[model samples]
Structure formats: structure tokens, C-alpha cells
Target: MNKSMNVFVIIALVMLSGCFPSNDLEKKQVHLTGITMGTVAYNIKYIEQPIDGGTPIPSDVVVHQNVERILKQLNQDMSNWIPDSELSKFNSHDSLSPVKISEGLRRVIAESIRLGHLSEGKLDVTIGPLINLWGFGPEARPEKAPTQEEIAQAQARTGIDNLMLEGNMLTKRIPNLYVDLSTIAKGYAVDLVAEYLDSISAHNYLVEIGGELRAKGFKHTGELWSVAIEKPVSTERAVHQIIIPKDNAIATSGDYRKYFEENGQRYSHIIDPDTGKPINHKLVSVTVIHPSSMTADGLSTAMMLMGPEKAYAFAEEHKIAAYLISKSENGFIEQFTVEFMPYLK
Candidate 1:
């Protein structure tokens, strides 16, 4: 399948699992859903009440418009597919000279670089060339696996050391060093939307972009916001677990929904930067909970690349609240960090 088409399917599957409330919910909460960042959908659920019993909360229409505007601006700055987006322009630049970037993009790129180090270079933004070669990027899927020579060439152009961010300016250590922020951009968008909601006094709300989510405060009924973790099976959509995540962000990365199988071999879109190939392991999905959705997003991808055992150990060492699901002959095996147990339902 085309990468874009697969993304739409993934978004649809994400939407199917707790992206909206059930029909029996109270009417006091405002729910809004819309498309953003190509194939992802943004869902916002917030409680509506008067301020000081005198000023009315912003109308749903106004809130939606504001959210859309914020997301549009974010896309313009970070989307690599936009051709003229800031990231796109930077990628196409062949100079080692510093290029000034928007504060938002700068923050995201800096965080991505920091995560690349934290994950032992597992989550590299400079892996774009390899990703495109593996048929999981903007380029069309190839008819066969890339040749060793092709893979070597792509790998040569990729490295976390090839990029640097100083203040609001980003510079490349090597020419034609491409950087793709797809792994972390949606999560940043989620955080950005959540920040905007807070600015408007939408304290009690849930913000989700793509599959990354953040929730704060309580619902209209005085309960914490609930979210469902989808089972890792591709054949069916089932809730693996539900959690009332209060004042924290959640992100999940999985290979089940985004991969191509050929001759009984599966190639996932989640590439391991060090290998320049999709991760081949029993680990199927990783869900991370943190205060920053961006951090959780990057960590989930890094954990997936680390596979099951190493990822579990890494989570334990870092004291991160992470949930891991792995493929087994008996079906699936689920595990969680000590810190994550309290949120499981």
C-alpha cells in the first residue's frame, strides 16, 4: 500500500478506538474532531462552564477555529510533505550555514536530537534517506527490497551527528542530510493544542492528534479522562486496556498496522536508524506515558526499535511508565513498568 493510504487507514483505526465519546455521555462536554497533519485527526473534549458564573466559555465553533489555526501553522512549520514547509526547505538546503527556524520547530528538533542521544541514537531524524529507500516514506513503495549498495548509500547520508541546532538556528554538518520529524511532530502538535486549550481556560480537556494524547483536569462528571489502548492485532480492533490518564500524555508506537509482508516476511515502517531497516523482533507495540507527549512519542518509537527485552530493561532503568506488548506463540504477552501499573484498568 502507498504510505499515504496506509496512514489514512491507521488514522481510521486510531479513531475507532476511544477517539470520541460513547453516545450515552452527558451533553455538558464539547467534543470536536477534524483532520490535521495529512492523515491524522485531532479530537478535543472539554468541559464547558461559565467563568466566575458571569462570562461564558468560548463557543465550540470559536474553539475549533482556534485549534485549527494553531494546527495549520504547526503543519506549515514542521511538515516535510508540504514541499515549502520550513523543514522541507531546510532539508533541501545543501549549505552548512545555519538556517533560522521557527521557535516551535526549533524546540521540536532540539528535543528530537536530545531523544536520539537518550535512545542511544535509535530515534534519528536524519534517517529520512533510509526510510525513503525502505518504501515507507513520501516516495512510492519499491517492488523489492533495496539492494545492499542502495542501502549503503542511504545509510551514508543518515546520522544524528549530521545535524545540529543552536538557539533558533539549525545547521547541517553534511550536505543533503535529510531530517524527517514525522515520529515526533504529531505529538508536538498534541502538546501545542493542549497548551492552546489551557490558554483559553479549557483546563478540563483531552487533546489527541494522530494516536498521541494528553489529558488534564476532570471531565464534566468529575471523573478523570479515559483513553483506550488498542490491541496489537491487525485483524481486529479490541481494547487491550483502558486508563484514566490524569495530567499526563500518552503515546503508542506499533508495527502491526503499518507494514508490508512479502513471502512470509514482514517489513515495518518503524525503522531502526542504526540498522537502516525495519525492526525485526517479537515486540509489537510500546505505549509510553509522560508529562510531555513529544517525549512519550519519541520514547515509544525508540522502545519499539529496542525490541522487547532491551526495551523493558531500558524502561526500568529510566523509571519510565511504559507498557509493552510482544508477539508469542501463545498469542501476545503484555508487560508494564512498575510506574505504569497504577494507570492500568
Candidate 2:
């Protein structure tokens, strides 16, 4: 096993001392490889079922390489911007013919659109035009803030409602609407990595991508993996941590991560679909934990756009656990739902 995996295994054993049936353990790290939609990494750790000691290094190294390859394919194959990508071709043709798509692409898009509707169109995949108009991502940077007219035009062409799913084929209701899957692609990739780990009988593992995390079973120490929530603006460290003990996924969305500075002002990439403008909420970050990574992933963005108060209320109404860190008039304020408070370890 690699040094890092060794350390995690030690931690897991210590945590499991009281919970697990036996002290003898065989820990192995598997580094999976493969790239499908974008960039992804799976840090998987598994305990030998019969306590049979085994090598952890070579197996882990191979797994890592496999995961990388999968992510690469996903990025190229599903990108909507690429005219030859599966997604773009599906959108280009107006016909409702059943088109076969990569299972990964189909699953992610279906989940994204489902979450968009569940959030009342708060988390939209068709915000690409608006995202580009605002100079985010690969879209050209606007020299200055776009006029209200320009913003409205982009907004008119963007919406989750514009997506039409017929049989195995996907078509856009709006002629020029383009779909951007960035919001949920990372989480979907994490989900795929988790599936692969399970297929290999790797039970204790945690997968993370760009900050989104999904942990199953226990950490190397035998205790639940403790993931820290980074303070907004402080990428080097986490302000709080959540200990994972069960099968759950967590995703945090904030304006601090992706932004551009111009004329002494910082503009975030997160845009409010309803307003057709960037979100100016005082929230620093929002962490959402739920059963599905897709839901946890998209809800975090929606919560950021909804602001603290509304976000909190939404979480409460849906019985979802959420942790919101906001910029108060004085300093920072942290709020959590009743269900989420317990995870604030």
C-alpha cells in the first residue's frame, strides 16, 4: 500500500477497535483508472474479509490509473460544447428518434434534470448560455458587465424545462438552448467511481472530486471518515468537519471557488437562474448531505442561489440536512438544520 493509504488504514483500524468484530485486518488501497466525462479520482480502501494479509500497493496503483482513464473518456464523450460529443449530436437533431447514449451520460443528465425540477427549476442544466454570457468557463469573457437586455436574452434561452426526454433520446425544446452539465458532472463521476469500487468488493472507501465527496463504510482508522468543510476564501484548510459513518454523499457549493477579479471586484460563476444574474447572496458556502450525490450536489448550488434564510427553510421543509456558512455583518455565521447538526463533528 502507498504511504497515504497506510496512514488511512491505521486510522480505520483504530476506529474499528470497538465496533468491528476482530482486530486482525488486511487493508488495501486500490487506485482505479479510466476517464469518461471529466476528471475523477477514486481513493478506495478495503479490508480483507478473512483478515488475510495482502499487498496494497500494486492493486491501488492500478485502480488509480483506471479511474483516470474513465474520467477522460467521460469529459470528451459527454461534453455538450463538442459538436461531435454524444450530447451535442443528440441536441443537434430535432428528431425524437431513440438515440443510444453512454449509460454514464444518460444517468447524469437524467438525474440533473430531475433535481432541477425537484428544486423548482433552481438547478438548471441549460444555463450554459447565461454562464457563457457572463464570461464563465470556456465562454468568452465579456469586457464589461452585460446589459439587462443581454442578460434577459440569455435567460430566455436557458431553463430545465427546455429539455425533452423521449424514450432513450434527448431533445431540446428550445432551438438554440445548450446544455452544460458541469454542475452535476463531478458528483455523477463520484457516483460512478463508487459503483466501480462496489463492483470490486471494496466496501470501505471515500471518493472525492473537486470538493464533492462520497464515503461508504469506514475510514482506515475504523472510524467514519472525517471531512473538513473549508472556510470560504480559505482553500488551504477546513473551518468545520463532518464525520461519515454511513452511506451518504456530501457536496459544498460556494462562490469563493470559481470567480474572476476585474476592476477591484470579484464576480462569482454561480448564477441565479430565476434572476438571470449572478448570485449576490451573502452566503459563503453551503454543504448539503443527502442519499444521492446528484441531489446533494445540485442542492448545494440551489441553496447558494436561494440565500441562507430561504435555503434553510427549504432544507427544513424537505427534511434534508444542510450546513450553511454565511457572511454576517460582524463576521461569519454558521447555521444547520436539526438533522444536519449531528454531523457537525
Candidate 3:
């Protein structure tokens, strides 16, 4: 796992759960892969389940269009890069009054708030100011670390408490509040697509966006969906582990590949909203499995920010299945909650 998986999920070469089907469904399998969500690409493999009694699956073109439609709407609603996106417009709004928002945006923001509290504000969606200050956002990178006063000013502009939601409306106590769903939006989008496949009677499927992924049913061969966990190394791509999701969602967050090294110190793109600075911890990556991709997404990010010891404790306390990799004097160390032992190969 790397920052690409956390930031946008740009790992396209590794097919974590892209499996083949049995002889019966071999020719019926429909696989779709393409770029979306600004930079990352999505890979989906599914077989349309029988409809009514024995009705055949719709043409591949129809399924393609349907999935594309869903993703396009998500980008329109949550993309911070799009000037006219729902999230961007919300950020541009200077009024304190509640603004009417789409149901989808409201749901995503609502989940983000819950996670913000769960991680003690470490998994903030309204952290655009601080992200920009550290040269990770739309702003250009600064030559040196931000001054203490500058960090304080950015901190003042952020906080999960600053945002409020009522019904289908959203409100920002401070007008300049900006929201970026980079941490979890891809997973949310993956979930939405999975829901669509379910609606169309897809009996078996694997949905992956960037590196956030979810799988369901079997491969038409009686095997559960298997995915690869990446080794936390920047020089090359290698599998750290292979595990079956057992009809669940999985998300991994790390920064081995996307960070700056200066004066013998490394700076991760993942910001600690509380500190208003990049995380400097030894923990390198976090992998979480959950029923909901959105939850797994947020949990992975939050755990990464917590470092190793605290993350392991939190995962155990919450009974979450988590795998953590951290830097060591010699090389790296591995630890996972007991719940994760079941998924190990």
C-alpha cells in the first residue's frame, strides 16, 4: 500500500481480486476497467445473475453505461477539483445558512463526520486548508515547513465540529470551510457501483476503485474473492499477502511512494488534523476490512494517522480486523488484530 491508494488509488497493475470464473460462467463474465475520480481507475468484474426465472443478462454495453453514469454523478457531487462540483460550490459558499445539497453528498458528509469523531478529528473531510498549506492540495508546495502561526491559522479553519447537517442540507459555521473526500470517496463510489450490480442481479462481483476494494459471492468456482496486499516499498511492486475478503470491503492506506524526504526526515501526505501537519510516525500502512467500503476507507486513514501502537489498540478495542505495518530499525514490523488472522493466507 502507498499514498496513491490513500490519496487516489492509482495502482492499476495489481489485480487484488480479479479472478476467473467456472466453466459455466466463463464466457458470461463481464469485466470493466477504466479511469475515473480525477486520476485513479476502477476495475469491476461481475457476472449478471439470472433474472425472473431464466432471463439472460443485459448486453455488456448497457452495464457499462449504467456504471459510468453512477461514477459521473459521484464525481460531480464530491470532486474537489471540479470548480462546479457540489463540494466545490459548497466550499465557495460564504453564507452561514444551511445550503440544500444532494442526498448523496449529505450521506458522504454525514459518514465523514462520524469518522472524524471516531478518530478524534484525524479523519477530517474539511481539511482542505491544511492540506493546501502543506503543498498536498491544489496549492503549490512550499519550500519549508509552515510556521507555527501559519499552522495555527489553518487549524482554526478546520474541525469536524464546524460543519453541520440537517435533513438534506449542510451548513458551515465558518464560511471558508472546504471539504475533500479523497480519503474515502473512492470507497463510497465503489460501494455505490456494487449496489448497482446487486440491483441488476449480479451474483458474483469484485469492485475496486483506485485501491479501495470490495468483493461478493464466489467466482462461480466455489472460491471466495482473493486480493493482494502490497508490500510497503517504493522501488518496486510486490505482494505482501493474499487474503480472501469473504464478501466484504477492504481498504489500505500508506505513504511509502508519495512523500517528500528532506534532511533525513520523511513527510507523509496524510495530515493529522489536530496537528495541522504531515504525519511523522513510524507506522507506514494500514489495511482494514469491513462490511461497508466507506467505513473501511475511513478506518484505514484514521489508523494510519494513529501510528502503530495506538492503531493496534483501537482496532482491538473496536473489534476491527486490521493489518498494520510499521518501520523498524532493521526493516519493518508486522502486527494485526486477532480478527484479521482469519483472512490470512
lDDT of 1 by residue, 312-341 (tens): 999999999998888877677788898898
lDDT of each: 0.84, 0.70, 0.83
lDDT tens digits, residue span 27-49, model 2: 44343333344343344444433
Candidate 3 lDDT over residue span 30-141, tens digit each: 7898889778889888866553345566777898898999999999999877889998899988999999999889889889999888888779998899888888876788
Candidate achieving the largest lDDT: 1
Report the candidate with higher lDDT, 1 versus 2: 1
Tell me the spans in candidate 1 whose CA falls farther than 4 Å from its real position: 1-27, 50-56
Q: What is the TM-score of each candidate against the true structure?
A: 0.91, 0.84, 0.90
Q: What clash count does candidate 3 reach?
A: 1
Model 2: per-residue Cα lDDT at residue 131? 90
Instruction: Give me candidate 1's TM-score against the actual structure.
Output: 0.91
- Prediction RMSDs, each to the true structure: 6.1, 6.6, 4.6
By descending lDDT, how would the candidates be arranged? Answer: 1, 3, 2
